[model samples]
Target: MSDDDATGDTATKPGDDRGATYASFVAIGDSFTEGLSDLAPDGTFRGWADLVAEHLAALTPGFRYANLAIRGKVLDQVLEEQVPSAVAMGPALISLCAGNNDLLRPNGDPDALAKRLAKGIRELRATGAEVLLFTGVDPRDSPVIRHARGRFATYYLHIRSLADLYGCRLVDLWSMQGLRDWRAWNPDRLHLNETGHRLVAAKVLTALDVPDAGEWHKTWPLPTAPTASRTENARWAREHLLPWLGRRLRGTSSGDGLPPKRPNLTEWP
Candidate 1:
């Protein structure tokens, strides 16, 4: 997965949205983009992309979404395939979440990841979508991911620079939050669980200046100055249960006092 080499995660069906009258949103990246986790099943963009979409539906009047996320996709693959799609859609907003796959895929070359990511950024911006670059937490904290933290940190900062260069908004979850916060991740310790996604989405919505962003903020309050361990499972439970209850009680998925039955793709790799 060199910067020049292209590789992608498992193949997936493009998202389905034929009747949406809302502003189009396109997401590009790897498992994080695809929402790979204990909570998200295969072929779903369960991460912040979905959360953002849900929030936007409430505020934007009528926003649609197109997730170009492919699991295992390196920066190069996204630059080639996903970027073009974003250009075609001319989405109102576009989010780019890459680099993790470059770290995970065999032969993943970190040295050039920044360059490839920047290339993708340039293309996404060309589509006129207000590009949103999401800087997530370091995966190395999990113990299973092997790259050195220093290297990933370097790449992360460089990606931030690219975002600034492109004048795109950045949601630096990594900088704003700590990885030691267990509530930040699901049980799999890889992709973000529902709680993490909500937090990330709220941050992005605020950063992007999206309307009514506060509605997407954390519904569950942290245990008065919560410790990392205490908040971990509690956050997980909130992520799983809150949305379900809200949706069920409301009886509508999107409007008129009903939240869409946005089911979590709670499957595995």
Candidate 2:
């Protein structure tokens, strides 16, 4: 697939609400799954996974949800730490969205990452849990990392293929036209913002056949051109991008000792 649009949308058909109902769900991945930029009023992360869980809880009473995602976790960390624990929960549904952190690394190999992801997904599928997968956002529009667009595309294609092989429901984030807007992201220009999270949650519910998923997919107005101006670029480098590189150089991560936000499946209050 040469373009981002070419890969996804093959796994789960949109608007095909199969009336599926899951009693519980577990989301395992990196910061995206952990809801970094999408913060709650109380300053807690409440990203797309939480929103999807909310919709699922609405359908099934006493629906339990667990989020084992941590910030800055590479695929290996996710597989080694989060995946095993999520599998143990035995949730009826599992959403895996790791590998972005790995992709950001200079040595990141999409093919090798895909192989690891497939193993994790296969393990999740073996438990009779309906696995949810995702393709990353298209980086073509982001000036900061647009040069690596091909790398992200490679990962997206692999994710699409893996989803098909494992029969996992997929939320094709790269195909969502609404997220092309810069307003969908926070200042870091990496993680999705609250609006982006809302859109992603809608996509996830739609993939899972949640009844009210349609209400969240409204068309969004484009930003005044999300192009990175010189000033904006400088600010992003100082505030977000440079620090990320420093962490990589120092062999450290933001989630070095932090625990999962929702480590256990419990009724979401």
Candidate 3:
């Protein structure tokens, strides 16, 4: 978006809560925002978006939050299903994180993904709400996903560009040094573990200029370091990678027929 394109300041920087008294928040994306591996005691996803919402609720009375993200969704799906609804609600703030599922594909194009994302941001901003954008984590360390590092890096650049152009708040997860640890990931190595999700929540809150986002940025130690044993790799391939491939080959999605965890903007619990 150009300077003449956007109407409001939307969001500025680290602590630029300058008139940013966001009373309502809507998160639209994919599994990451849906909370994935970060499960509540009830075995449901409660990822970073929820944490941010909870914190914001305490700060503002009647603060409402909605997360319309479903697992296995790509950028197109999110824009089609969730973006329209979020735009209709006209929340004070909207955070969007997606496109990784597309980039993971053999035919994924970073430039195309960025263009699609930029279009969404433009539409969301037109609703007079702030947009919070996220960059994908570095994939250099993961053997399975390492080959996509170049693509992800390119996508990150586009993400930053769009955020700057649109004056949207940015939660640059690729800059999170703590994510380099394997313990921050689930056994599948494709999603964030509880620790990783908590850290991401902190980053998002910080971007929104929320105080006391927590000490999740610190490099906390884990009981067990990540390993590269063949047996372990085999287990992951069998249980995670193979299944994911099978689903793709069968033209199915893990999130098929699933509903948004939080379909409406209600007071955060």
lDDT leader: 3
Candidate 1 C-alpha error for residue 72, in Å: 1.8
Residue-level lDDT of model 3, residues 1-269, one tens digit each, is 34333333454332345535579999999999998889888888888888888888888899999999999998899999999999999999999999999988888898888878877888888887889999988889887779989988988888887888777888888888898877788998988988898899888877777777776575756547457688899998999999999988997899999999999888777
**Position 112, candidate 2: lDDT:** 79
What TM-score would each prediction reach against the true structure? 0.66, 0.90, 0.91
Query: In order, what is each prediction's RMSD in angstroms?
Result: 12.4, 4.7, 3.3
Q: Candidates' lDDT values, in order?
A: 0.61, 0.83, 0.85
The number of residue pairs in model 3 that clash at the backbone is 0
Better of 1 and 3 by lDDT: 3
Clashes of 1: 13
Query: Candidate 2, residue 143: CA error in Å?
Result: 2.7
How high is the lDDT of residue 78 in model 2? 93
Task: Give the Å shift of residue 194 in candidate 1.
Answer: 1.3
Worst 10 residues of 1 by lDDT: 260-269
Off by over 4 Å in 2: 1-17, 215-218, 222-227
